[model samples]
Target: MSDYICNWDHCKFEGTKNLAIRHVIITHAPPEKVPYFCTLCSFRATNLKAFERHLTTFRQHILLEKENSQTKEYLQISTESYNVTWGNRNCDLTLKNEKYLYPEPNIVPVLLEINEDYTVYNETIIESTASQTEENNENIEKLKTKHKREMNNLAEYIIRLEKKLSARDQEIFELKRELRCNEPFIQGFNEMWEDQVRDKKEQRDRKREDWRRGKVAKENMEPLGETFSSPPSKKMKSLVKKLF
Candidate 1:
């Protein structure tokens, strides 16, 4: 990399050789300025490339060569000629000329009147904006209050539901406790009733067996008494013959 410095006395631009040359050629010593001169348009340039570019670029500029020593260059830049060539060009020069050189200079007084009107319009806009801002603030405050109230009501409703749930849970707990407390008593009562029923069944079965045995004994005694009565009858007959 070769370091190249600018040769211009006041220019401190420096870079690599190609970059510095381009910078100097393009920026500081442009082609329209120095050693390259165009005899046709009396335009000076630094290089042949610059001269060729200027010739191509400003081909619209007319250079009239007279038989005299001096050549006259005419730039057709007047407003009428620009309108004729470019068609209806609007320029600031015409407005400036109207404002400055006219006998009356109509724009400043009209601008003053507009400024006064704008001041009144701006005040009215500011007053309306202030009123709207105040109204918005009041509406926002009311909405905030409504939101807080609704949130508080929701919280209270939640609390009430929680309390009711707690009460229901307590009721369920008490019912379970009562069932547990009565379970042993209920079991004992059922066992006592079963024992009483078993004892009554055994007593009834013993009374039935005793009644059956008594019936059988009564039937056997009736048959034995008949057999004894036949023996007694023979004895009576023998005694009566002896007496006779």
Candidate 2:
């Protein structure tokens, strides 16, 4: 057998060329026919955005290079290109990358406290404080809304199914009713057919009996003119001789 090898790193699948091609086509390529190959890993996506997400969010290659957290060091903050970190380690930023105009860390507050009709901001912590409480509430509300919507949709679907089932059942009932109504007519037809067969049999038997009786009578009958006692003549003698 010819060797068909998958060149993707960490992949152990080896087969014939056709099998390897089939496996790649089925596993890596999407049905939409777009090719999105991952630069770092064996993962393939259907579109560029999906490939980018796979590169940043699901960084299988980046995580492979990540050392154990026992070693601690200050990592620089990159501003030129946005990148998601690999592990659960924090990086102390001394200077931002050249992408951002501001030297200080870009701060965007997620949640604002309304104090006497004025929005208050906490300057110390950059990013959203909403991650502490509001995020969970929002998630819970979204889940509830989604669940309710799904339930309503399911209920509507069930109602449609029930309606169809009811209509089908009604149609079946009507067919059964029609069959029941025709039962008497079917029975009458069967009885008429049986009666006709019986009558024909009786007529055939009567004919056979009549024929047998006529044959017996004919066999028992005397010769022609035997019952008439006439004078002994040459003509009668000749007729008797001929009949005998």
Against the true structure, what is each candidate's TM-score? Answer: 0.28, 0.27
Q: Per-residue lDDT tens digits of candidate 2, residues 6-71?
A: 433344444554444433332533322213333223343323344344334432333423553112
Q: Which residues of candidate 2, in runs, are more than 4 Å off?
A: 1-172, 225-244
Whole-model lDDT, candidate 2? Answer: 0.46
lDDT of 1: 0.45
lDDT of 1 by residue, 43-131 (tens): 44333344444444442321222122122232111111101000111211121112221121223121100001111011111455456
Candidate 1 wrong stretches, greater than 4 Å: 1-125, 186-244
Clashes of each: 1, 0
Worst 10 residues of 2 by lDDT: 91-100
